[model samples]
Target: MTARTFQATNPATGQPLSPAFPVTTPQELASIVAAASEAARGFAASAPQLRADFLNAAAAGIEARAGELIAAAMGETGLPEARLRGEVGRTANQLRLFARVAAEGSWVDARIDHGDPSRKPLPKPDVRSLRVPLGPVAVFGASNFPLAFSVAGGDTASALAAGCPVVVKAHPAHPATSRLAAEAIQEAAAQVGLPAGVFGIIYEDGYELGVQLAQHPDIHAVGFTGSRTGGLALVAAAQARDVPIPVYAEMSSVNPSVFTQAALEAKAAALADGLAVSISGSGGQLCTQPGLLFVPVGQVGDEFLQQVAARLDATPACTLLTGGILKAYQQGAAGHLAKAGIQALTQGAATQIGAQPQLLGVPLAQFTAELADEVFGPISVAVRYEDLTEVTPVLAGLEGQLTATLHATDDELDGLSDLLHAMGTRAGRVVLNGFPTGVEVGHAMVHGGPFPATSDGGSSTSVGSRAIERFTRLRAYQDFPDRALPPELQDANPHGLWRLMDGERTR
Candidate 1:
């Protein structure tokens, strides 16, 4: 059976973009999954050097097509040229970083304990362990971050770096951008002489495709970034499979920011300005956007909110990613306004399809459980707390988040040691004094969190070199001969890696 085709649309002008993407038929999807499943063995067996080369080639391919990728992404996403260009650079850099990770080889976490037949009553057996690939992965391209989190995004890079094949399900909102990015990956794989199925891209707008992809026997793992409903759907599909797979879904967060009396007083103007950009930047589509902010009631009181309101009043209107996003934002904001204790501090002025930044406020007692919910567009709620005692409970009441922030002063830290601990416990990352919008891609970066923030179970990130670990699992070898042992575990140290030998660290 022939599947329908989906055309991309320009979010900026709501016009159709060229190069319609075809949805895969069940037969075709089966073929693609079969190819990837067949290719997974060879990909997992391929030398780390070869995989590194492929990643480097992929980086080069993306760099070579920077202009075209950025242009298409800008047109489809309605993001500024500068932002699109930066995203392309980030994507290319991320690929290179993973390439370095592949070449360095420490990502395998190889450890060897040599046979110690001497001391004890019983001799210890030689034991060696290292991580290995989990086979093919199904990566869901996110709509908001077309370049950085889509087709050739971190999920694919990490999966491939871990020696797993990847099949990308392109986001409908930016199908054109996804197609171009996927082409770069394909070309790079071909250049590196990797199997054609080592990387695959499928374009589909419906949930059926996603459900099938998740349920496919060949797909060993899943990676996704989107709304809670979408993420949960994938999770449900994967769980219902005969052999359930891990689905790393970065779903939703109300990344809450709490203000200290000192920090707010000192950085009030600056915080207002920075939060304004963070909340609305990229049409307020960022997963890390501060959705809820907390302020002390008695000390800062109405003055702090008024100051923030004035600054936001100056913030110019910007277009949201899509009409649906705008509508959701409007509905969410309207709901906040109608709630019992919440008041519309600053209502939006936008008549177009753009986001008119809005701020809602409620006293500590009246701040309901619903206030913690994230409004996807350029809107946030300010919760006023009476005392530090009330602060922790309110913060603890919110669900899991990607980030929780504290704008505490040096003097405040003494009083806030417990509060800071509480904030860090609830969030994946705790921001000390700055905004939570900008998430850096690094080894220590924890982009994933508990529950609704992510499906990773607070153990991994979709961003960083550590992300490669998610695509792999540990394999142990016991009592293996020197000649037959893998290079990473052999005494000759062919790979020259650091490992624990009989409890002593060695190279």
Candidate 2:
């Protein structure tokens, strides 16, 4: 089959960044999946350490070309060079983290329940359990996170580490960057002598191919990061398949931050500036960006409003990712401004394709009635309440979010522990005194939440080694012969890694 290409255009300059490519056909997608599935059978058989080496090499390649990738990403996505560079670092760091996780091997949760050899009753049968790949995984790229959630981003990295061949449906927003990253991974695979089909990229212009990819029979699971509507649509399609598969779809959210009276009193000005930067960071395209601010009533709230207004005015209007996004931001902002009793506290001068940060303030009741929802841009809604008692009810009214932050003094936190717990239940991450824009790739980071935030609330592949769990499945080698066991889980302990024996953790 012949390969087709698509053109990438710079959103900021209205110039063609790369030639357009033809969409991957259903027949081609099937062929790609067949090869990937075959490769996954062998890749999964390889030692975990070998897989880790390849992943680490991929990280090195990404770091080596960080500058070139960042420049291309910035041009294509209309993001600043600094932000793109930071994202590149984050992308490479995530790869390295996953590599280490794969090397450790315990993430597979290998458990061996040896027969009670000396039991008074009949000896129990040996039972062992281990995680195995869920076969070929289909990942849908995200527009905002061209690197960290793109072609070689968390989903792809985690799937590959889990021994699942990955086929990424590239986001059209940054095709050139995606192609470049995909090339790096292909090189890493070859250097490690991994199968060529272990990683594949499909460039498509619309959702039709993505839908087909998710519904394909050979595709065992899917990883998606995008809008709520898009994610849910994929979920529906997956469910409709004859043999339904799991879809780990992380949707959108309006991460809310609550400021207690004491914190607002202590550092209103600094907090205001910090929020301005967070809201406007990457033009507020991040899923973790704090879109709603809850402020206490009285002098502190008034002071915060003043500081926030100043910051918003001072921040410049930079170009957004695309004209569609800019138009959406304008429309969403205008919709809120048009709502009854909603007042614009501060409005920044609009730019041709980008918008300056805008601050809107309204009465607690009125704002909650009108603008408490997400607008998906560099726009923040400040809602003031009479006291702490009014905060919980408002937070409770919110949809599930990726993050919820609290700016509070120690005393305030102590008093609001219950409230914080309640808020924690509603959000994936409950942060204190910090904005939610920077998501750390650590064991404790939970980057998914309920409903609109993410389709799966019980388990989120957000941070740490657990991210690979989404692309893997548990397989029990019940009462099977030794020859049937995979090498990684053999009795000889070829990998020299930790495993569970008789329900106890062991090395």
Candidate 3:
């Protein structure tokens, strides 16, 4: 059956600029998921080197067409050229990094135990266990990050690296960019000799297709990045399944910031500069932007707010991702102003598809109630506190956050133990004297947190090499002959990977 098509529009100029995209119906989408399910089996049995080769080639395909990717993303998203280019580079590097992770062969977390016939207790049977891919994954494209969090993004990269086939739901806002990325993946799959259904991309403009894809019987897991409401909807859909599957949704987070008295006294201006940039950059579309700034009340707090206000006023209005995002930002700005205690430190006008920077000041006494909602544009609310004791309650009111930041001083360091402890309970990543915008994709970056920030913290992370584990589960093979055991679990350790053997860590 032929699917109806839609045209992609340029956010900045409100003009159509697509090569045209076909929005898949539920039945068509279900068939794609089933194909991925079948492809996952063959891909999982393929050698790790083979999978790694496909990932590397996919990166090459994106890099080869970097110009088109960047231009298409720039048109769909209002982001500048440099930022778009950087995201393109990040998307390619992420794919290459996963390729390296696939080649490492140690992520399986292999373990082995030989039969103990000599022990006084009954002889134990031999046990060998290693992680294996869960199955086909359904990844939802993100509106903010077309390439990095969309087709061939971290979710797709990690799932493919785990040897699972992927069925991605392309974001409607950037169909041209999504199509470009999908082409790269398909080309790489064919070049690397991957099966026909190794990768599939389904496009849709509404919630029906996403829900169908999530509830599809063949899908073993789901990956998503978006608003709290959207992520929660996907979570609910996945749970309603008879055999529920895990959904790793990187959702909402109003990442908070703290400034101690001592730090505020010395580096007030510097901290203000950093906070202003982090809050307003990319029109506050980044999940890690410091949305709440807590300042110690007094002359220091007053001066800090003034400095940040100056920066905010100077920030020029930028084109947002879409009309919907602009409307939400306007509603948030209007809501903050209507509040009894909320004060607008800096204000900007809203256009049909544009938003200016907004900075509001919320008093400490009323901050907990007034600033609980997230403002998803170039905005940040500064909260001023009279007593140090009041700080804890405000932090307590926050829902789970992706990051909590503090720009502190040496004198205040000793007394921050309690604040650090409190921040640890609520945030996934804590930054000392720094902004939370630039998340490094490395071994230790935790880009998720408790509910609202992320759907699942125990099972996975949305960024870094550790994300590969989200698509795999452990299986134990007992009483198998040496040759029958998986190569990684064998006594010889042919993979040269670190493993837990006979109750000891060995290679």
Candidate 4:
């Protein structure tokens, strides 16, 4: 009967940061989706360059308001100003990158096959295919990447670029930032002459509205970035629909890193510092954070653990993203410590909320069972192994991960090639001698994995140009005349881009 507003609270101070706006009810969500569906029809008919202009304008808007957005993100998320600023840069860069890719017009994978007049018995038919918008898309905001994975983030940008209207479900953790970003998108849409309903944000406190949106008949696809439980719930909801739609849900992972003997022997202390920063950076809130680490046994391994423990002791406990996240992190850390074979190698004294980082460690065997799970906060488990022989089995036991890192020297890489291959099979992306925290938004990055890592491995990342594929569908224009061909697939080559011709790659 009445609309309820969702409040945004400062994680650090436990104070109300801003007044809330009216939450979208199921009926409102339906109306929004309907409007988006209608807008998507007309938007899809517009030229690709026009869509590019909107994305470019959106990027400029985001950059102009970077200060306000970053401050609001920090105030609500308890993240440092520098981190928020960097995230804002990532968000804007992602939008611009998609804009460029969309403007290039090659991602559609347009193809044409000219009719063969001299066929054996029958004349060949002209065949053409191109990617089209799947229609209205429902995006679930991620708590971790408040800016880059939220309202004006990659999911929304790529979908819009692909000609799909986006209806975002705001994450409860950073409602203020979500609303601000939504306003930016709305302004950008208006400036670019796009329909107002092309982008909508539903600020619902409960998850039911999101469920309804996912199952809505008009919504052609769903893009999500969140926990396993939540992502799976959306997948189930989508499946229950009369005609199931694809749901691209990136869930949780314990992104594991391996340290070969040769590399550790060469730079044990340096690796220690790098791992500490990677594990503790952003309070270990990043999905790509190295949660499980496998180290080779011997003096080198012992030294690595000792250095890690010392660093853990020195580091202080920082406030998590929210009170709920903090509580969960504390419980997870305590549970691992209480396991039989596990020992708290080092435990930092808890600091005031939003003060400093928290660090903890456990033995290899116990951590294998107890700490393999993601705690989603500032914590990591050092799982030491006797040799490379034991690494595969340990990694094999891990759930799906967004990334797996191998710190190996040139000589060690040859011997560990099998292990790396196996890790690659299990993870969405494999890294060598690198931390996974700084995920580059490029063509090479694969930010999804199996099972709990993501619901659909085909569409995981919200960064880079690959993201546009999620919001598009392929359509074959059989026996179509040359005059009726889409602009990207016309014989005249209006876009002047590469395309596949009769199974052959060509321009």
Instruction: List the candidates' TM-scores in order.
Output: 0.96, 0.95, 0.97, 0.96
- Model 2: weakest 10-residue lDDT segment is 457-466
Each prediction's Cα lDDT score? 0.84, 0.83, 0.86, 0.82
The C-alpha local distance difference test score for the whole of candidate 1 amounts to 0.84
Give the Cα-based TM-score of candidate 4 against the true structure.
Answer: 0.96
Rank the candidate models, highest lDDT first: 3, 1, 2, 4
Cα lDDT tens digits for candidate 3, 333-411: 8988888788888756566777777788878777655476787878888888877667876787688888888778777
Judged by whole-model lDDT over C-alpha atoms, candidate 4 comes out at 0.82
Pairs with steric clashes in candidate 4: 316-357, 318-356
Judging by TM-score, tell me the better candidate of 1 and 3: 3
lDDT of 1 by residue, 1-507 (tens): 455888877866778878777887778788888889999999998888889899888888888888888888887778888888888889988998899888788887778776778848999888899999999999999988998899898999999999999999888888878878888888988988998999887878778988999999889999999999899999999999999999999999999998877787787777777877887787678999998988887745577778777767677777777667777777887777888888877856444667677778888888888888888877888888877678887777678889998887777788887777778778899998888887898888889777789986678888889999999999999998989877777788776677776677767
TM-score, model 3 to reference: 0.97
lDDT (tens digit, per residue) of candidate 4 on 1-507: 567887877888888766776888777887898889889889988877888999888888888888889888988888888888988888888888888887888889898887897897998878888899899999999888899988888889889889899999999888888888988888999998999879988888778888988998999999998777898899999999999998999888888898888888889899888888887888888889888878765788888878977776676566678877777777777776676666555656335464344444444555555578888876777776776887787787777789999998887777887798779778988998989898898876778887778888634565678888888888988787778878887888887879988888887
Worst 10 residues of 1 by lDDT: 347-356
Residue-level lDDT of model 2, residues 1-507, one tens digit each, is: 566556777877777775676778878888888889889789887778888988998888888888779888888898988888888888888888888888888778888876666776676777788888889999998888999998989998898888889999999888878888998899999999998889998988778889999998989999998877898999999999999999998887888888988898788888988898898888888888888888887877988888887887787786778777777788889888888766777768457767888887776767654475677778888887887778887788778888899998887666897779768878988898999998888766777887778888736755556888898788887666677887656788777778877767777
**Candidate 1, superposed: residue stretches over 4 Å from native:** 1-3, 117-121, 298-301, 349-352
Model 2 reaches what TM-score against the true structure?
0.95
All candidates in order of TM-score, best leading: 3, 1, 4, 2
Per lDDT, the best of the predicted structures is 3
